[model samples]
Target: MEEDTDFRIRFSSLCFVTDHVGFCGTIKSSPSDFVVIEIDEQGQLVNTAPSKLISKILPEPNNFAKKTKLDLQNLSFEEGSNQEVSIFAGCSGADQYHQSGSEREDTISDGTSKGEEQTVDDLGTLLDEKTNELLNHFACDIKEKWNSKTELIGSSPEFSLGRILDKNQRAILHSAIRQKFPFLITVGKNSEIVVKPNLEYKELCHLVSEEEAFEFFKYLDAKKENSKFTFKPDTNKDHRKAVHHFVNKKFGNLVETKSFPELNYSAGNPNVAITVRFREKTHKHRKRSLFEYQDRKVIYTDDSLRLGQLKGNHFDIVIRNLKNQINDSANLKDRILEAIENVKNKGFVNYYGPQRFGMGRKVHTDQIGLALLKSEMVEAVKLFLTPEDLDDPVNRAKKYFLQTEDAKGTLSLMPEFKVRERALLESLHRFGMTEEGCIQAWFSFPHSMRIFYVHAYSSKIWNEAVSYRLGTYGSRVVEGDLVCLGEDVDDEHFPNNKVHLVTEEEESANTYAIHQVVLPVLGYNIQYPKNKVGQWYQEILSRDGLQTCRFKVPTLKLNVPGCYRQILKCPHNVSYQLKEEHDTDVKMEGSHIDEATLSLLISFDLDASCYATVCLREIMKHDF
Candidate 1:
């Protein structure tokens, strides 16, 4: 566990937050030794539990129903006009809550409940008598069943879904649809999702204010579109009260739904309307997830590596198997504990971690990214094909492919699980290994992977800026440092890219702190800082062979708008358990009075894009 001084020197992540002496230990000695759990935007712990549910296993009616919100709440009417369906919101997290592993309490609409099993009888009940004629499960041409449900159910297909605002969950549901029934594709009018003419209504009354109800109709009048719907009528108080469970569980109030009974029971008077039409254009984010993200306009395809991509998202991490450093101090454990406390309190530099740079590989992705930026496709492809990890089997395959230009021949020797390599090879096999072919081969990757190299190169520039900030200004809020309107306003749905520099007056007033300060990741879209750091940013780009970085690569059809990240990161709820392992080796190198075997179980919660390894680096004082 030695410090990678070379990387630190090059990337500019060379400084520590604390002045305390540091110790060293090995990390990820085993797979279980290091564990990471993602905390999504809702602050709920994300796991594979949702996939384990029987409903998610296949694309059946239950599969669609599983994610499709029981939220038939969007439908309202012109106060005087009956059966004129308008959409309204429920008093819940319509903005924040999408199909985020939430299970709604209310059963199927039309109120007679069968289980998740999509039987003929259940279909008949759900579709109001048309489904029996429409749904044919056992028929010879029974390839796609969900299609029949769409036709029979018409505009009220949301009964099959208990969706929220989580785009990832929507993607998961849509993926199932695409897998089973490839024909569920198509954006509706308004470029969202199309709705059927027949609207299905299910009214389980809770309560909403008279004014909220009126405003609800107004919102629907202006913003009515397909995929955003709910049709619920006031059934009873208990069912409405049960709406509490549905609201709390599914939306958690991310999207404000005025239709919920409890929100404003006594709006102006002592009461409000119990029976009502509630419509909310639910397809806003859901369809955006389906279609908008294909261009990756706002959100990344993968779990976000960038800061606050999943707004408020964080990580719950555990680091174990900590080897005690050999030292003269009588209290080595105390020293280690003190270091951990410093990291907990003082925080660490929010540098992009080595994983972003492709640490284990012989060549880093940032190098490849820079190559791409320079339009050196051959160099970039060669860098990508380079081998690492001290005798990986792919080395032989890569060697044969590069030497012979035989992508298909190399595949037989290549490992099946090496999907990126396989994909590159397949593209090359089809497109031939010309310069254009090489660029296209890179394009064959998912948008995220294709964009990642550029992101990494930008990350290197960001890291350099961070290093300059810490090293020159010393991690303090200074005059001309960039600060957001408030805190980090990186919500993808509604981003606030606006930033202002701290003035001398503001700095004197202590208006903006270091935590509030930000550094650009460097791109065509982002504005640089106003001070010397900004000058460094410009100089860095010019040094990289461009006066300004190109955000678009027309050759690759890639567009990378820039982003910002915090300069410093502090972990939350930090705690540690120091214990000796069961069969740990006790070291007694030269001089030891009373030192026994030692290990640490260090745990912390870090916000999205803050590296846990960087936190551990601060504690361990080893850059590796």
Candidate 2:
């Protein structure tokens, strides 16, 4: 009787036992017997017995056999191998079987050439090709199911097979398919795939309001040619103007080919840029007008304005010491670095820098804000228009006329560019000189300037609060101290510098950083911190004879919801260098010097809403 043994198999061939246990794997020959490296249901590879195993082949409906044979031939060759070989399987067309590592000589299968021998390299290639074909078929089946069910197929068995084959390769293939096909697919940050267009697409379609669309279309019909519209300077313009302008130029207007935001060169810091749309016919003229309008308008001589250039809220500044005064007792470089590090680690009390107020010694802009808050319109108007003797002759003459002459007569003396000021004077002239008339006249000023005053007052309140907090608590957090979690604005748990009061347990834990304390920007909607800090906020407002509810100005439609901000800021990417000054005639620190001196140059970036001068004050330990 002949001895019974298991049969040899190709890679990725599905096999079944008499007991109906099924597996897919490549076959390898051990010294004594044949073993199948099986891929389990979980897509993990494992060794199993090949005894009583039978191959299960699934046939395709059209040209299945021919395509399979072609695929096998195409994929069988190993990379960089020169040898030519053929694969023969034991099936309906085969006549002989060759066992791997058997001592007996190879016998030809009926379909292959007689006396041809197979190499180990040929067998490995055959296995690899079949394995890849199985994986591709598996991936396609999973994709079809995913499309039908309209659900994620990440946990599907077929997807697991494809993942086992190649992880990054499958991702690239899916991305390409999504881009090429008509169907839309969205992949989220967590790799969750959804068959839907992005939310931004829907938002783009509905960006223009019905009222805006009607007005824009009405103007387009009347004009026929593209119209040049300029927004009122110094006014608080709506941000939606940009969106409306974009939609009108892209789809509504018949003549316009492009649209862009118009750069406002005259608006001071935190300037608002207007949106402009134009046709090909007006493009050249509009371009020329922009150059003429903004030329020499910026405060800095080196700055120039173009149509689309917008200002960023954040800025980086470099400050250098004009003269490096060296002393044996102290090293300037070491002192500067130590000062910066100390501020970074220990934190400095926050204050509204000099720029928040007007530049002149006689006027404080915060006072104007306070007068507006108190509804003292006459004071607000006087502060806005009155020019000191130090001001330019043109401005001084205009101020003198406004103070001494009647409102109607003073209008003629005001400059043409003083549109807001002239409007206020005209209102005062028409409404009479009562308190109500003065209030109405103040209302004629630009809404932005009115809001600026309110902001300046808020800054002053915050500066005082910071000073009080530091004076009482010093730099470290004590029991009942309020500490901010982190610096992320989008964190759901701690949005906008949310703080938690330190309990006795937390104080003992000592995990919270001392520099995490934040101060409040006083407004109607803000809840004041509990303790001395809260008392300080109340005292400041009480001293000014103002209430938090006063921030809700119904007449102006301005409601400020307050927010918390860090009491200290650290400079990032800080660096310093020393260079010798070549000029001898220049004065150093108000002293006449004939010798060349070394200058300390420092550079760093600061977060938005924080002043660079604040950091410099900490480093210099002196007022500017």
> How far is each candidate from the true structure, as Cα RMSD in Å?
20.6, 33.7
The TM-score leader among the candidates is: 1
User: Candidate 2 clashing pairs?
Assistant: none
Off by over 4 Å in 2: 1-329, 344-347, 394-405, 417-420, 490-497, 584-594
Clashes of each: 49, 0
Q: How much lDDT does candidate 2 score?
A: 0.43
Candidate 2: deviation at residue 530, Å? 1.2
Per lDDT, the best of the predicted structures is 1
Candidate 1: global Cα-lDDT? 0.51
How does each model score on TM-score? 0.55, 0.46
Q: What would the per-residue lDDT of candidate 1 be over residues 474-583, giving only the tens digit for each residue?
A: 85688989876755354111133467778999978888767677888766677778899999977887888767557787788778777778777887756666666564
Model 1 scores a TM of 0.55
Whole-model lDDT per candidate: 0.51, 0.43
